[model samples]
Target: MFETMALMPQNFSLPDAIWRLLISTGLLLLAIVILRTLTARFIRRHVTSSELRGRLLMNFRNGFLLLGLLGLALIWGDQIRSLALSIVAIAVAFVVATKELILCVSGAILKSGAGSFNLGDRIQVKDFRGDVIDQTLLATTVLEVGPGKTSHQRTGRMIVIPNALFLSEPVINESFTDHWDFHVFTVPFKREDDWHTAQKALLAAANRHCKPYLESVRTYMTKVGVSRGLEVPSVDPRVTIQVPVASEIHLTVRLPAKPRQRSYIEQAILSEVFADTDYSTEKP
Candidate 1:
C-alpha cells in the first residue's frame, strides 16, 4: 500500500487516485446531464430562436462540461505534472500514432471559424458532393448524392469528411437564393412514353419551382447591386429534356438553387415525373 500510494498518478495511493478519477468522471457526466436538462427545460423554453438557443447551449453546456473534466483530471492526476517532459514526449508519440486525427481536428478548427458554409449549403470536397448535414471540430458530414447539379437518388450513405479537405479542395455552395429548379424525365424506351410530353411536364414543373426564386433573386440582386455594386444574372428558371446517354433521357433543370432543400426539389420533380412514367423510381 505504501509503495503503491507513492507511485500513484498524483503520488497518492493508486486506489485513492483511481477512486477520485472515477468520481471526477462521474461528476463531469452528471454536470452534462443536468446542463442538458436545464437547457431543455429553462433555456429552450425561454429562448425560442433556434440560432440563439444553439449558441447558448454550445457555450454553457459544452464549455462547462469540458472545463469540469479538465479540472478533475488536474486533481486526480495532479502528480503527472512532475513528469511534464515525459508527458510532452508521450503526447508527441501519441500524435504520431493518431496523425490523421490530429490533422482532421486541426482542419476542422480552421473551417469552424470560417462558419464552415452552413447547414443548408451544398459543398463539394474532393470527389464527394452532398448537402452539409453536420460539422464538428474533426469532420463534416454530407448526405451523398449523384454527380452533377441534379441528385437522382439519395445515396442513403452518411459521409464523414475530414475538415482538412477544405484547405486544399474546392468547395461549391448551391442554392444561395430562395429560388431553385429541378428536373426528371421518363425513359424513351418505355411503352407509350411520350418523351415530348414528359419534357413539357418537366419544364412546367421546373418553372413552378423556379419563378418564385427568380423573382426574389432578381429583386434581391437589384437591391444589392445598387447598394453593394454586385452584378446579377438575367437567366430565367428553365428545364431541358435531353438524351444524355442512349438508355436514359436526362431532364436538365436550371434554376436558382434554394438555400438548403435542393434535394427536396429534385425528389419532388422526380416524384412528379414518376406519376407520368414510373420508370426507375425511388422514394425521396
Candidate 2:
C-alpha cells in the first residue's frame, strides 16, 4: 500500500485547467449577479412607470444572461474545442472499428427497402448463386443452387454470405416470377451441317417441351409488363441464331419453364434436338 502511494503523484492537485475553469465560472456568475442587481436598482429609480421598470429590468437581466453565456464560452473556448476534437476522433474510431458491421446493416436495409429478393427467390450475387433460405442483418443463408447457372438443382451445400456483399455486388434474381418464367438455353452446331434443319429441330424441341406453361408464362409476362409499365420480351418458344465464329452456329432457345426445372427442361430439349439432328462435319 505504501509503495502504491509512493508511485502516485507526490504533489497532486487539480490541473491548471480545472482551477482556471472554477475561478472563471465564479467570477462570471458574480459579475452577472452584480450587474443585474445594479440594472434593476437603476431602472426602478429612474423609470416612473412600474411596467416600464419591470420591462427594463427583464431586458437588462436577459442581456446579462447572454453576456454571461458569451463570457463563459470565451473563457472555456480552448477546452470546448479540445473536447469537440476528442469527440470527433472517438466517432471516427468507432466507425473504423465496426466498418464491416455497419456495411452489413446498411446492406440489409438496402435489400429490404429495394425489395431485392425474397426468402424463396433464386438469387445470384457475384459468383454465389442460390435460393435464399434465411436472412438477417449481418448475413444471408442460401441453399446452394448449382455448380453453374445452367443447373437449377441444389448441390446440397449451404452458403452463408455476408450481407455486405449486396452493397458491393450486383444481385441477379433469376426467379422473380411466382412459378413459371422464361428460361434461355443455347444449342451449338457446326455451320456446314445443315444449320437450317438444326434450327427447326431445336425450335420443335423447345415448343414441345415448353407447351404446357407457355400460355401461363405469357399471361404473367403481360401482367408484369402492365404493372411495371415496361415491354417484356416474348415468352413463345423462339429461337435466335448466333454465329460467334465462322465454323460454328449457336441456336439460342428461349422457352417457359419453372425455376426448379430449368436444367431438366434444357436437357430434355437438347436431347430431343441432338437425337433428331446430326451436326457432324468431317474436316478435310
lDDT of 1 by residue, 81-182 (tens): 667868899999998999887788878876767655777566677678877789887889888866554454557888889887777777766534434322
Q: Give per-model CA RMSD.
A: 20.6, 4.0
Best by TM-score: 2
Q: Which stretches of candidate 2 lie over 4 Å from their true place?
A: 1-12, 37-62, 275-277, 282-284
Candidate 2 lDDT, 157-209, residue by residue in tens: 99999999999898999987887777887777788777788788888888887
Q: At residue 135, what lDDT does model 2 achieve? A: 96
Q: What TM-score should be assigned to candidate 1? A: 0.46
Q: All candidates' TM-scores?
A: 0.46, 0.83
- Quality of model 1 by C-alpha lDDT: 0.67
